[model samples]
Target chain A: METLFSEMQGALVVMPSGRLDTNTAPEAEKMLVDRIKGGMNQVVIDFTKTDYISSAGLRVILKAAKLLKGSSGKIALCNANAQIFEVLELSGFLTLLTHSDNLETALGIVGNPA
Target chain B: MTFRTILNAAFPPFSEARRTKPREMLFSVAEKPGIGTTFTVSLQHTLIVLTMVVYTVIIGKEIGLTDAALRGFVALEIVVMGLTTLLQSLPTRFGSGHLIVHTPSVISMAAFIAVANSFGIGAAAGGILLSGVVVIFFSGLLPRFRSLFPVEVIGILLVLLGLTLVEGGVQRFTGLHEGSFDTPTLLTASVTLGVIIAFSVWSPGRLRVFAVLAGVIAGMIVAYLSGLFGASQMAVVSSEPAFAFPLGNYQIPAPTLIIAAALPQLLIEVISAVDSIGTAVTIDKIDDARWTRPDMQMVGRTITAHGAGLVLNGLTGTPPLGTSSANLGLVAVTGVASRIVGTATGIMLVVLAFLPQVSAFITTIPRPVIGALIVYTAGYLMVVGMELILSRLLNSRRQFMVGLGITVGVSLMVMPELATGVPGHLKPILGSALIMGVVTAAVLNQIFRIGISQTARIELSGYSAAHDAAEFLEDRGAAWGARRDVISRAGITVGEVLEVLHNEHMVEGTVNLQATFDEYRLMLLLDYRGKAFKFAGDQTLDLAAFLEGDEDEDDLALDAAMSQMSGALIQNLADKVSSSSQKERAGLRMEFSH
Candidate 1:
């Protein structure tokens, strides 16, 4: 239902909350563009408070991640719940997007990818 | 003859013989007398998107990635996807009364890198936003443009787009290159495919929800079991929520650059609306001829709404995507309109919003397995495209052009992107292949038009035949319903008045039941639509006069009826009309029981 993007250090961190369903995926997508245009290459999308992800939502994120790859940028996700994780895995997002245990980890990993 | 006479004649055993006139247009579900199924229709739409997305992903892979190219590409994808969801959701929410299709936009996507790389990232982003604005502004004009771009052409365009994508479909079975395939990948893909097929064929109910999904699941299981994946294989997605608007530093580097990106995006936006509407029209036509469907106008509304969604994409951190052809594939199989599935799908998406780990797992679905899904979808598109040509676009003269044109046109684009020296004039436009295809097709079609008549009667005989059939249905079923709905509404008005009168007290004494019944009968006959045409003509309904006459409150029968017709007295005379038709109105059974 809502996607919030902010520059955390040198990386863009996106925290999503609410339903994030079909009607709200656009908000998530818009957040991605804003960060990219704002010149933040490294991004983190947090799903700690989110509920689910559909094919439409996954596609938007995949597209953004793919774009980031070109800039030598990385996209890391954090705070995903169970159902949300299951949906991502099912739709093949696991291969395209990265995840972290918490906000700090996500920021650390995206900022300094080992 | 008055309306009563006509009603009598229509059901008469004692009257003259006459033919029943036809009703106007009808949708397939509307033609049938039952509650519409949600699952099947949702599947069809899902299939369309699934198929389209599979190929789109392949195309995305093929397009590869470059720093600048990736930015523009990502932005374009985000824009398309974001807008598409909004577009599809709009009509479903606002215009459920009509049929409206929302699908992918291929036009602006191809040009994403071209315009962006040539100008700047800000320019491209601004252009994307501006494009949505244009679509919103001209949303009203889109349906009218349907006359300009016929459904046949739209169908042809899709067929061409599908044929072009078939290469990716083939790559599903065969690996992309020399080292892409192995026993594990093949076995996993086959197992997944088998699961999908068996579930699709044998299992019913919610099993359908995850057949493709299950296939991916099974494939991933097999992949992990075989040591194909490990900790190092994990992918991370952004967790940042979207909070910005479409402006800021993403602002146009220059006003001129934004304007430059506008034209191409507009063309694609329009094309997207047309393509979706055309697909809906075709699918809907197959079932019911009497249904009134949403037109290009609704499509425009949906697209404009989608564009507004794109502004969100700019504000968010995701890439834009348009409607996926996967939905079209869903429509093919289910033939129902269960937007609830779409809603469910949205739910699933929101779920992913909270779980990047889970989404990462989905993305990890083996490439070959993903390839399998693509193969299924693309193959279906080819089949669907052929169905279009064979069913609607086929004919003697135009068949050659429609068929061969689509084949060759799509094939040429698919054959190989010949990176020839970029022409000076085509510099701005040549960046996107979809744009090039549109220009090429238009040019070729125009050239062909010199020798071929632009408006020839025999241009596309099959297409014209289908159109004629649609027209025939509209004249009968749609016309009938319209006529009936009007008269029934009118009848209800007078009926309600009479119903009130039947309960009214008169002269502070006994109710005049006879007077009330007569007034009610007269109102029923005159205020009905079917009754308006009760005279010599089959369609003529003259219902105004009888209903307009004033009834005196002095009538004793009406007063008596009012007294006698208590709640306990005439429960049997309750309204029985379900459909809004004059016939239904006339069938209202106000009976006198023992």
Candidate 2:
């Protein structure tokens, strides 16, 4: 699987394919912070197609969550499927990241927010 | 001793700072307690950014889109969305403190929207590829300048950006976007807004992370399960193509909106570079870490990111902006200072680029959802602006001039009709946010005597008078005397050493010096550059010295790279010094040859 992350303004947006487990968590976390240092504060984890995220992913999320709390920005989970949501819930990340069924719902929070 | 050893011996000792692992030090924040801690991404920002994206698309579709493209959009929406969210969630900077903050700097979105709007499903991959180039450039440019950017001006800008989107988001909410407001539309908009706000502001602990998110999800689910409106809403169950060819793409579309808007869009590029660099410097200072200059890497990366974005906009049907403050928020919260994380992000961007399936799904975030996130982002911008204002140490006068001017100028220029009489031909030229910044800076500077661009000169030699030259001077060997120099009042003879006894910039310091009265006078110049200047005796004897003592012990290999244009600048200054009695002092005339 491949994971790509980038930032615009001060937000980190990540795109991860395949399973997010212990093995890839470090890689993912590293990529997340690097893109963020230039200007990423808010992050959107698009999990629409993510098959599963293990406790490893949880660890990564927890780490990221804790990091964001210090700054005044936070993370939001978007595009999670049922399996992904279940996994997030089990791992406790669901509580930390704002979740949307799709990108549209996530988009609703801005200006003339729905 | 070998010649090499002699040359190496000439270099200074290691300044402890270089030995410190910037990367590791950056990452260590998360390891601490109460300082570096991460929280779940705020649903507020998630909704905000996502909503803006959807809103842009909804409005854009009204202007230009086909039914076939809409269907393709839905299918694309399903595939890479998880990747998009994951990508969106990674903190750019590692650390803690930013739990609820978010910034709206989506530069890559421009290329995505452009590609989707113009090329349909064909060019999305190409757009992502192009946009990646832009981001890398931004990373490079963010470290050259220091803490010049604070939230004051930025706060106003954010407010304006959010307010500007009001029309678009409201239109989407009313279904005026599609020319019909059904029950589903109102239900979706209202319930979604209320729920999201509740989650963003009132949610607690881990539950709070998903607060705005929970609201949006619940609102959508309610609409779907309740059969609130469109029958197609239930069609999500339909089994569509699970994946699409993200790479090995086909057909580039015509140079449509994507290509047409590159110039105006570049404004985001330049501003974000400045903003990014400013934020980086602030982070450094806040952490009490080693000083790092915002340099070519940051500036270049930022511009290139925007330029590359042309392709992303051309394909993905997303407006683009240079990611800025959000990363800081991420760092504030996460406290993970791993550049490796950024590497992961870069790799993720690459994955997103090739996987059209991925870009497709990320594009599906709803307009209203993104809209709410936009509010969060704007709020963050305001906070950042405040940070900038404070950092700049803006006093009452400086605050009134810079802050008020930027706010008013930005709002006026941003407003469409305020300058309605402006010719269409000049619209692009005059109607610019960056231009607004420059004007505000200039006008306010004049009133407050904060001249960001007033050249200082001696009646003898013309040069940039040292305003913020402390760093440059310190870097050089001139650690003696505090300030650089003062404006010369007397019209003196040639060969007199121009020592700055009292630099009236920020601090006051003396530059001791003397005189040699040849027709070609001996002038001592001290400007911030590669090398430093030193002076000893009264305004009788002073000399320019290479800042050889500031180098690291191992920096012997890199001393050549330390000074940028100082040699040429010194030479130029020396060359500019001419025989005043002979009527050829270029310093006085600046090559005013007749």
Best by TM-score: 1
Q: List the candidate 2 regions with Cα displacement exceeding 4 Å.
A: A1-114, B1-52, B55-205, B221-230, B236-240, B247-250, B254-321, B324-370, B413-415, B422-439, B442-594
TM-score of each: 0.48, 0.42
Q: Rate the local accuracy (lDDT) of all candidates.
A: 0.45, 0.40
For each candidate, C-alpha RMSD in Å?
A: 29.7, 24.7
True contacts kept of each: 0.00, 0.00
Query: What TM-score does prediction 2 earn?
Result: 0.42
Residue B345 of model 1 has an lDDT of: 39
Candidate 2 chain B least-lDDT 10 residues: B481-490
Error at B591, model 1, angstroms: 39
CA shift at A7, candidate 1, in angstroms?
Answer: 88
